[model samples]
Target: MARKRGREGRFVSTVEGAEFFKVYLPQFSSHQIRIPPDFTKNFRRALNEKVILKNKDGKTWYVEVKETPEGVFLKDGWPRFVDYHGLKVGEFLVFRYNGSYSFLVQIFGTNGCKKEKFGPQNIATHVKSEVESDNDDSSSVDRSKLFKRFEEEEEDNNNEFPKRPSFVSPPSRRKMLKIPEEVMNNENVHLEAEVNLRNAEGKEWPVNIYTMLNGPTFLGRGLCAFQRDNNVGPKDCCKFIFGNQTTIDVKILRH
Candidate 1:
């Protein structure tokens, strides 16, 4: 029998110059950055509780998800983490959530260089500044409205994630494949997951995996985004990891 799988989610954002440049921990209740609605909905942990943040190099940090009127933020270790990583404005940060409390953070330099680890050795010591309450300009974004939109959309659609197209036959017309009885007899599994596809250059690209019962077992979203960024093609093979807290690894055979 095949192994059971779990779900995954991701949120990629470019560091805004105004928001990420300076240490904002002093102004907030604890050091944290406002998280997206999807993040909060998926995790649903209580405010002021701790969550584990693992970096690409396997380093871990315990950070609290503090809920505020504006939204939720990752507090506690954020400032030191940011400083160590030398996080700069305009750099892209890819946050891959494991459909639970933990998140894997990958950093890309402004020039798209991959950074495996961030150490405090190279970073200058950050002196905690006086709490400047007025500097908290982030309060302008009304998170209640944003949260409402997500709630309404979830209620109306009843689908957690968006589904995209499945594997298509190439123009040459591939031969029909047979479905094994074991797979056919397997119970239907539908949930939010992710596929980590590696390009020719070996860069890890994560696409949203939406599983279904019929026709094809796995359908993926954000494939186009990965293709666009990585220039992947039908001839190139990829690897897929599916699950939430636990995961199963599979490979996509190229046509």
Candidate 2:
């Protein structure tokens, strides 16, 4: 499987899963299609969920559309996916790819009339914001209090007293999954890590991390639940081996 992703991921041994978190654009002469107000509204309406494919024998695919009209261009629609939506003035549709194993799509095209690459860094901010927003909505708590509390904690962390030079704090119970540096950049790399998580005790915790690949280019990233920790063992042991991407700050948005 590793060798397979390497070949498909352009010899990259890092990226896993063919476009796990990415939208797979087709290997074609990708051009742009100006947005029609109708399309803009409809594009997002069907993101990452099964939609009717253009020419499918009933095989629907998922799509990640970026509705852009201003700023860093690729400020990425997944962000103001709602605010910046305007499909009337003329938009571009690069190309599209759909997933077979899961409902996923990778779109290839331009943002604000310019070419764009579907990379991890490109979507990280949008993804992070979306995730936080989703969690917040679920809690629907006092938004003001949440922000104030978060700010206070942030400030306090910044004020933590320095420890003695000779004193080293114990390692975190979390483990970071090993991903080869080569994997982070290979556009075609597809990776899937079967993470096993165990808490400080000795109870088995479920873990699974998935990342997708673009064409034969980008070292993309995927959806992983390791913010939960990557030690797959007992529920109490603080030691683990194959885990990456740790969650430093945790917020109980729903509690």
Among all candidates shown, the one with the greatest TM-score:
1
When summed lDDT is taken over every stretch of 10 residues in candidate 1, the lowest stretch is 169-178
Model 1 CA deviation exceeding 4 Å by range? 1-30, 124-255
TM-score of each: 0.36, 0.22
* Residue-level lDDT tens digits of model 2 in 30-94: 22223334322212232222222221112222223333453111222122221112122233333
Task: Report the C-alpha displacement of residue 116, candidate 1, in angstroms.
Answer: 3.4
Compute the lDDT of residue 139 as modeled in candidate 2: 47
Per-residue lDDT tens digits for candidate 1, residues 139-208, read: 3534355434544654676844332211221111111111223433445422323335454345654443
Local distance difference test, per candidate? 0.44, 0.29
Task: Give lDDT: candidate 2, residue 170.
Answer: 16
- Tell me the lDDT of model 1 at 138: 28
